[model samples]
Target: MRYFFLLVLLGGLGWCPAQAQAPAARHTFALGPTDFLLDGKPLQMISGELHYPRIPREAWRARLKMAKAMGLNTIGTYVFWNVHEPQPGQYDFTGNNDVAAFVRMAQQEGLWVILRPSPYVCAEWEFGGYPYWLQNVPGLKVRSQEPQYVAAYKRYIEAVGKQLAPLQVGHGGPVLMVQVENEYGSYGSDKQYLALNKKLFEDAGFDGVLYTCDPVADVAKGHLPGLLPAVNGTDKPAEIRRLVRANHDGQGPYYVAEWYPAWFDWWGAPHHTVPAARYTPGLDSVLRAGMSINMYMFHGGTTRAFLNGANYKGDTSHYEPQVSSYDYDAPLDEAGNPTAKFRAFRAVIAKYRPAGAAPLPPVPAAKPSAALPALQLTQYASLLGHLPAPVASPTPLTFEQLKQAYGFVLYRATVPGGRSEVLKINDLRDYAVVLVNGRRVGTLDRRLRQDSLRLALPAGPVQLDILVENLGRINFGAYLLQNNKGITRRVLLGGREVTGWRMYGLPFAQAPTVAAGSPTPAAASGPVLRAATFTLAQPIDTYLDMRQWGKGVVWLNGHNLGRYWAIGPQQTLYVPAEWLRKGTNDIKVLELLRPEQTALRFLDHPILSELSGPQP
Candidate 1:
């Protein structure tokens, strides 16, 4: 073996052979003026992108195996800040969020790691992987050097660095390269910000090669002086070389940091899929020309919980929210199964892998899934019944304003002189279900930009309730500045402003107690919380079919199964067998829209690709 000597050195250093031997630490990774050097030998990153948070903790190794089987020597992943630190200063690296463990797992699987710890990772994830509490940091502007924002950024970097810096190749670990702020060129050309990012990495103990990645057009503006500039895209070799040359005086080791095998999907848009034939030849050309490439998503996993982000270019752009299933139509499906693209790409990678490199391990078998019997969610609880104490406010408060990150917010106003009028919520965020005195009125959707709904107000005193659902924060582009969900502006009724409001914060950070055993008073209110139990003889991965339901979120055994809508592309929720028990398991669904539901079901397969005619 070429790295046999390196294995002896590592073994002498008291490291376990089984975990650290295969991907021999032959050389300290370094960046040359033209190419990357491993123990002074030229190296290229034949990597596949995978996110740790997307895949379940139990499946990390299996996914790594699948990645290696696809002929990748390196695995690239973004460390999501929000997943690690949901709250400011409260970091969580345990369980699925344990990135260090993931890196070690990669090492064990004989793979190198490319760490992209973007405190703000715009992976169509909620708030670009930034903690939602960052919005509450008085006068904070993100992706910039605003003092509060920059301070928070540094702290996060330090925190993540503490966990991962020790695993760098320089420290005898598998991590070869670390990326600076992700796609900074697409956001801004702040040289100082880019330089600060590099400095932070150094200060935090990341001594290996640091690189900055941007789309081909943005490389010049995004790259810093000392850091390597890696272009991202599927551009032709000539164009890619031209772009790199224009940015830096380099003739060798071009790196496509993000080669898009496929694209991400917005809720309303059709599921994106690129034919394998469309890029295999390009892959061959790049490898032949000695360029390193990392597929954006080697395997796109589900966007669990309410972690999906939205997209809005600006005021004029359409507000499109991302669905829960982030199956980016990649080589590996969301379920971690190989696809046609996987087979084709494996063939291409096999052809291009370094001479005499070990043959890839056998492809892993697909995980078994089951179609469960229709589950009857007999128990019920309305959101109004489960709300915490009201935050009495004269005007409606945004989620950030109320120190709330996600879930729903209830804005209730007592209209004394009630009449038939046009009720306008000047800036309604996402989705809102209007209620007049606990009676359903009409629904206002942000996708349709419907802020006002006709109200037939009773002549007497009326309780006007506007329950707003914070779908997700805008993850990318210019609109990220205005990501605060809920009612941003004033509430108007019949051209007259409605004041005196009682706002209820339903972060739903924890699952609420519902009326169990028997149905709760015949389901006569807003946002019913339905409960059901299912028994499994032998637990296996199954999908909770949400076609029969309306819009809501599901919790299996108190674990958030993520948001579901009848306006599907994604009709079923992936319930991992790891989350199931051998006996009985409880399912709780907090459906927001349709309260007329009595039963829920599970399917053997996922329905993530069906486009419902045209989205409203």
Candidate 2:
């Protein structure tokens, strides 16, 4: 036994004795002058982005295994601040938010990890991954050096460090590199803010190599003096090397941080897709030039609930709210099954495997899918009937003022002896349904740059109500600064400011309860809650088809399945089998617009390609 222990210590034995087992092997990952060095040797990292919150916890391993089969050596992910700290100081790290477990899973699957724990990750997420409570902070400026912003950011980062700092490669874990603020230069050129971000990460105990990623044009502006610079949205091998070399000390450890194989979809647009042949050549060239690359999304699971974001190009005319399905036309489908693009990219990757490296794992088979018969939603409840007590206010309150994060808010006021005049809501964030005496007359949509509707008010003080929907906050560009939901400004009638409002906050943090077999009230012309129950012999992954339903949200077995609109593109919500039970399952729909048919079906596959002409 002693001889065997000696042999193990000297590395002469195949296995170590139980009592003589050494600590886990620690590694050094650094940026070399000409390459990324892993323990003093060059490593060509082939990584893919996958978010934990977007995928079900039970499906994380299966997705990671699929990534491995596609010949990925590294997995990149963003730590969404909003997902962890939904409230001001409250933090959650268990279940899908368990990022440490996710990193460990990558290591267990024989893959390295690159951590992008930026406070502002603009991956088309709501408010760029900022907690909605940030809007409530007095004199706080996001993505800036404001003292309050910095202090809050510090607390959040330190909390994250406690969860992941020990998982760095230096501590015998899989995380190799940590990213600073994501794509900072595209938004602003504040060197102090960038420096502050770097310092915060270092202070939080991320001792590994730190890096910054930006578009090729912003590389020089975003990168710090010591941190490595990476580029996104470009795959030209020569241009990548040039940008990195120009930004750094004239050397060549080039990395493409975000190579876009395809694009994302927004509401009212056709589903975006890129032919596999269009970008496969560029991918081949990047690999052939010995450059490292990370696909923007190997699989873009789903952007569940009100967490989806919108895009604004400095004006409301360009406001495009993103759809529920974030599939990204990636190598893997929304269900984590490999697509044709996966095979095409894998073939190119197989050609670049390091000499004598282990063979790629066999591609996993797709999970089985099941279909359900049409579910009739017989029971209904009116949203107005189930109102919580309102906050009496002289003027309309924004979502932040009411301490509400997402969903709808209702504003009620009485207009005395009104005439035929235009009803305008100043600074309407996204969408609003205007009602006069319990009748929905018209809607004000920010997407079309609309803020007013001509109304013929009845005589003798009619009750006026405006239900505003926070479609999503702008996730990118300068518009993000002014992304407060609800009525930011006062309502105007006939060019005069109207006051005296009662605001009802409807954050919908939990699914609203409606009594079973309740009759549809006579005044149920507005948003209604419809419910149905069905049984499944064996629950399999399926898509909830909402083509017949108008705009609203859905829930399956109490899980928020996400929003759906008749306005094309995303007609189905991907429901993971893990969220379903083998017995009876309850499904509910909150239809903002009345459904053409009060029934829904389950599809074995997703239907994200259909387009509707115009919304009602």
Candidate 3:
């Protein structure tokens, strides 16, 4: 009788019996009163979250296969809005941002998908996954019912729908559910805003089971009246049941949407790790209860480029910028290799596999890695020599006002100098290198709440240059709305506002050209553009050891590999093979702080736990 029903289901979805491995076809997935109903039968979704933008496009299949081997039946992913719509009215869904293709690949790997396409996904992403251009919109209030914000969000949702809506479950795709605004209750209790998001998704053609996920304390506030309320950060079967029953209709279908097996790391902090023994018991309980579950990060990939976000809990001293590697230390590491935790979790899940289910595949071997001999950066260029035309302003302009998103910004002005004075830059977003007459004088760091520096000026007019780097935008808390990079306010000298500034937006949209020359003197300070070239017999996965380097950003073959700091925690950047070539490969480094050595190394393994002094 079960075989007969399976045949009928396949026939209804237009799948032929011979095509056993065909892509997912049209099907019904609905929230039941006591359980999630898949074609009128209860279904437990053993899922894991992996963002498309985080993983390289070429390795999406391998990552999905890894998830399956870990005994996961589904793949959960967040469609980063900023990744798709980088600029207002401008959209990109190609290459690494190809979310639809990722979903299709998941289906091809025999896995269902849970699509979280929220405009505000607090996934440690820049500006909470909001496009940086949104800040330039006048009278716009994000995460609210403001008219302009709503219009812009609707347009973005429509754009995403055009790419992903057709891949929903009912449309013969793998997406079983689409999420509402992520963790909105913790941010705000605006039911109207949640309703607007729901309507927007519907208008965008998301016609599957829609759900809202939040912490246990926020399920009631974030959940819509008719949608499923999923809990995060907890795996206790009783708590999960109680939260779902209380927010829902006092029934069942309890879902732990975000089960954290480990945590993420931030700059200047130790790498976070959770023991498998800590959470496997909770997993067993949830599985034994027949409740559905989705691991927050089954495979936490890298937060490449300037996309990493920070945490500012309304206090300057509390600001913590996230590191480039988003390797959440889950079952799968950043390089897509299974860890000991993977085997432990798989053992727990194996016992819960449904009857007649296919055996889990053997874990795939780790990808090959290569270690290169130490090489010196042979070319160097001073940032002062490569200045573009500056925009004159009476005062320093914020990155938003300058129409810039990421990278460094230079503020220069001529100040009368005769005596030493205290230099203060109000609202310095992140880090700055203060230089007088093209010579490094001092530095100010926002992480340490150091905004004022005592500088000794020469006996004549001196060129004052303040090079500011936008570390990462605040991704969580009330400070998220106040995120403005570079120098947001006035520059004061000895308790007075200094005016007449020439602002240069160094977005570094492309790798700057470094003329062939010997390396800059190690004694030199401030920002320097360094370059090196090498040839590879074959491209293989590797980690660029930035331990000897100071605070800076690196680019390989014109692709930005993100930032690294001598501050430790994350000592290396994962260099994917997909971004490398077999011939000559060019590499560039924009070192913000002077390094003792001008050399680089490639390691076979990542150095994530090493610690060093915060200063260079």
Q: Give candidate 2's TM-score.
A: 0.95
504-532, model 3: which lDDT tens digit per residue? Answer: 98998788889887567756665788888
For model 1, residues 339-378, the per-residue Cα lDDT tens digits are 9999999998888767888777788888898888887788
- RMSD (Å) of each candidate, 1 decimal: 4.9, 4.3, 5.6
Q: Output the better candidate (1/2) by TM-score.
A: 2
- Which pairs, if any, clash in model 1? none
Q: Where does candidate 2 stray beyond 4 Å?
A: 1-23, 417-419, 521-523
Candidate 1, which segments miss by more than 4 Å at Cα?
1-26, 520-525, 613-616
Overall local distance difference test of candidate 1: 0.85
lDDT of 2 by residue, 1-616 (tens): 9986787666665555653655557999988887899999999999999999899989999999999999999999999999899998999999889999999998998899999999899887899899989888878999899999999999999999999998899999999999999999798888888989989999999989998999988888888877889999898887998988888888868899999999898888889999899989999999898899999899999998899999988643578999989999999999999999999999999999999998999999999887778888877887777889999999999998998889999999999755898998888987888888877788887877788899999888988989899998989988777889999987999998889999988888787786788866655677788888888888899888888888899888877878898887899999999998998988888888773357788899999989985642
